[model samples]
Target: MNKNIILIGFMGTGKSSLGRRLARRLGYKFVDTDSAIEEITGKTVEQIFRKDGEIRFRSEEKLLVRKLSGQSGLVVATGGGMVLEQENVDLLKQNGVLICLRAEPEVILKRVKNKKRRPLLSRGDLLENIIKLTKERESAYEIADFSVDTSRLTFDEVLNQIRKFLQQEGYIK
Candidate 1:
């Protein structure tokens, strides 16, 4: 697993969970880009959004990706909106096998329903925002090398699918 396995997805799509498990299985480092940003800035993602606004948070995110591009043997779980920008995708893909995890809007809502940390879902209407954001990001996500819909699958199933993808892509033995 020389190339990083970069997981890109909407907020509730299991990028972080799967990335952590994949990293453990492969004995590679696991990095959640959002957590990295929070660590670097000394502020939570919601704080960044509330205090400085999303543009600033995205700027921080871009910087993080730029830094991560120079490293190796890590599974990167990107923030939901990371793929919204083409340049982010380009930089991450330069040394990573980018895979997008996917799920239905309803499924996503169900998963994130109780997660108050999601800044994007701070709006009053959860389901509506999920539908709108999913539509907005679908095209960008389509650029991934492969897609895994974890809406119904267990984590083990998701892991198997990702393992198979990595093996077929020659990233793993």
Candidate 2:
């Protein structure tokens, strides 16, 4: 498929993992926006958040989103807040299908609690933060072309669901 497969979701929703698997399965290049930003800025995501702050990080993300939106044959795993801006969403959809991955708040906490990598979740109550952020992004996530809840689903199962949607949409055979 020439069109990009764009994965958007809250953190810890398996975007990177599933994007890599889908890219390999479809023989497409895989790009994680966070990693791309890190590469460009010469810093980890946490460093960017802690040092440069979210606004500066988002500026970098917006630039990368514009770049990725012009390409084809890609499986893009976008950062959790990338679509918060309408411009990012419009640009990404121009040459791609936006697939949102979702999970329960508790599931999200279970998935990311051990990792200190998530800057937004580093604040007070982890579960409360997840719920608040998820709620805040609900509208943006709703604009996705397709959505899959990864909660309680195996990796293979979630992948299959995504694949089935792509097939039905004629993105894959």
Candidate 3:
């Protein structure tokens, strides 16, 4: 059975981008949970947030996590707040190595500020919101098996760190 590599982090932390690269390197399938949720609900994430509210969107996210937990040979980029629920962490860990990607508040704000798709930052001071949300989710994100700050690291450097961790954990050769 092929184990999975699951990336968990705040928005703009390189989960999706790094997940794609990691999947390619490991010859595994890549899944962005947010995109999958969008596909499943027939609505964009923003639409879901706008129409159904965050609570409803989180419900959909949980269901998707349950579904992904049953699969293998995947690299999943999870929604920012997915790990806030212990159940989601437990389910993913059954067949996955959870890696948290992190960045400073300033870096996060710079990376995500112009992206209108981020509902959480759509209404507030971007940097302040990033800091606030980071604080709120800090403990939750600690559930990850491994973590790396992507702020000063190049893509290859970040990938190498994750690869090294995966190797140490026996998830890769």
Candidate 4:
């Protein structure tokens, strides 16, 4: 199997941006799983959450991950909560080098603040909700093959760091 580069992290951790940069640098295809889902389901993420709820969204997310797992030479940016599903994690591991982009809560809060698109954070208690979600999801994040702190790094910096890590870990030449 061709090893893929899979980016997993909380929302606002720069997965999509870094994934795009990394794919460009590495000459690979870029796949944003969230966008794929949006296209396939013909609904925005907020709409999916409001209409079908998180459980249904997650199920669809897992299905997309499974479908993408067989592809080669792709850099995939996954939804923040995608790794929470064990099946998704397993499928990602089978086909990719899982990289976790982590950031301080404050950094994430700053990056995501006033983001109207995110269904989960479209409430008053933004910081509190981020803290709660981070606490609940940290364990899943820890399962990543590599983790990078993106709190202070620019998008290019983070992409370079991931490239170095991949090379060191022999995922890339």
Highest-lDDT candidate:
2
Off by over 4 Å in 2: none
Ranking by lDDT: 2, 1, 3, 4
lDDT of each: 0.93, 0.95, 0.93, 0.90
Runs of candidate 3 exceeding 4 Å displacement = none
Question: Candidate 1 lDDT, tens digit per residue, 1-173?
Answer: 29988999899999999899999999999999999999999999999999999999999999999999999999999999998888899999999999999999999999999987999989879999999999998898999998999999999999999999899989998
- Alpha-carbon RMSD, each predicted model: 0.9, 0.8, 0.7, 1.1
Cα-based lDDT at residue 169, candidate 3: 84
Across 1-173, the per-residue lDDT of candidate 4 in tens digits comes to 44999999999999998888888888999999989999999998999999999998998998898799878899999999999989999999887999999998899999899677799888768989899999999999999988999999888788788888988988888
Candidate 4 residues lying further than 4 Å off, grouped into runs, are none
Measure candidate 1: CA RMSD. 0.9
> What's each prediction's TM-score?
0.98, 0.98, 0.98, 0.96
| Number of residue pairs clashing in candidate 3, backbone atoms closer than 3 angstroms, sequence gap of 3 or more or interchain | 0
Considering lDDT, which of the candidate structures 3 and 4 is the better prediction for this target? 3
Q: RMSD of candidate 2 to the true fold?
A: 0.8
Clashes of each: 0, 0, 0, 0
Candidate 4, RMSD to the unseen true structure: 1.1
